[model samples]
Target: MGLRSALFAAQYDAAMRHAEHEELSSRRAALLSGLRGIVYDVGAGTGANLPYLPPSCRVTAVEPDPNMRKRLLARVGPANAVRVVDASAEALPANDASVDAVVFTLVLCSVPDQAAALAEAKRVLKPDGKLLFLEHVRDAGAHAAFQDMLRPVWSFAAQGCQLNRNTVAAISAAGFTVDERENFTVGPAWLPVNPMVRGRATPGG
Candidate 1:
């Protein structure tokens, strides 16, 4: 990697590592239940979700950054029974109709192409498969406008994490419908940015 790329990786690793454990843990708790068969976590940074997931469920965590993958390996233990792979959401390596479920936790905001990524998730899912996720999305009311206004600057500083991605719409556009979901705040009013949306995708491959 070039100097800038190395620096960015280092910075991202540090930033994620510095994140509040409670913030991540709470969301993981809500999304990890009822998972069956193959579980694919998009942007499985540092494998924080590995510990909470049931041992019975087979897991394959997809992450692109080598630095993050290294951290993930260190965090995941033999008891968790996880398979961490070098991958990303925009394009998955699994064969068609192979995976039973795809998990997305705070992943879509950073994807360069949201539609392509969701399409990939849809393509790999079994006919009876489901899409599970917990994300921070554009909220209702003035908060939504605030997200829109701050998205450009936020995306730049955060390395492509847009603050205003219409996550619900994107999923629908990708051909999967939202079966259930919830939204809430993850940050204070000033920054007012932290939020979580959890649900399953429905009525599509």
Candidate 2:
């Protein structure tokens, strides 16, 4: 990665540290606690979820951005049982029904194709595997219009992160049934990425 990407990676932790401490950290711990088996942390930016994952599970932390991957690799220790892979959400280098769970933490917003990405997640998971996600979705109220208006500029500046995506619908459309979920806001009301959801889903009939 060049100067811009390197700069983004370097600033990422500091930029999000406040929110992580105030809200996201607890959410991550709750969602990942006791999770076991082979898990894939898709879009694993800087390995933020590594500390929360249970030690028994083997984790594949997939990140395509070299700058982000560099920071992510630094967090994976020998005892962490985590491996970093250079891959995008649309394609995973795993076999069919090969993993126990797939995770998406603040990831759906930036993927080029939501349906394809979720489909890939489903494809690599076992028939009984679970899907865990923590994402900011399209606002359901009037702010949705505001989200749409700001999306173009936001996506450009934030590395393709869309501010108004109905990600739960995309998850369902991709053939997963959400088993449990909690909807809440992470920051002040004025923040565009407010109104997030953390949940668990399994393959649907």
Candidate 3:
């Protein structure tokens, strides 16, 4: 990884530690509860979603940043059914139609090409497979304006994480049919990236 990627990975866990509170934990568990069979966890930073996953699922964690991968390896328990792949979201290592489900939690915002990443996710998923996502998106009104204004500086500081990504639209455009969705506000109201969406999408019609 480059210097900026290295620095982000090094401090990633610390930067996000406070956000790993009870509320988010509960939400993650709920988001992951239905997943089963072979799963690919894109952007599995520090393996935050590992514990929340069902034991029936075998997870392939795709993370490109070396520093984040180090912490991710440390977080994986000996008994956990997770394999780490050093790959970016736009180029997953999995084979076509191989995985039962693909998981994306706070990932789409940071990828250089959101459409390509989602396309890759769709490619690796079986026709009957599902996509599980928990993402913060561009909100409406004043908060949206704020996110637009702060995006340049925020993306620089937060390692390419855009504060104003319309992730749901991108997912739909990638050909997944959204089946269930829940939208809510998270963190303090003042935060630009506070509006979040958690949902499940299935491949094909």
Ranking by TM-score: 2, 3, 1
Worst 10-residue lDDT window, candidate 2: 1-10
In model 3, the runs with Cα more than 4 Å from the true position are: 1-3
List candidate 2 segments past 4 Å from native. Answer: none
List, residue by residue over 22-132, the lDDT tens digit for candidate 2.
999999999999888999999999999998999889899999999999899888966666889999999998999999999999999998999999999999999999999
TM-scores of the candidates are 0.85, 0.96, 0.94
Q: Which parts of model 1 are misplaced by more than 4 Å?
A: 1-24, 77-80, 189-195, 203-205
Pairs in steric clash, model 3: none
Backbone N/Cα/C clashes per model: 1, 0, 0
What pairs collide in candidate 1? 186-194
Q: In the order shown, what is each candidate's alpha-carbon RMSD?
A: 2.7, 1.2, 1.5
Candidate 1: TM-score? 0.85
lDDT of 2 at 8: 78
| True lDDT of residue 92, candidate 3 | 90
Better of 1 and 3 by TM-score: 3
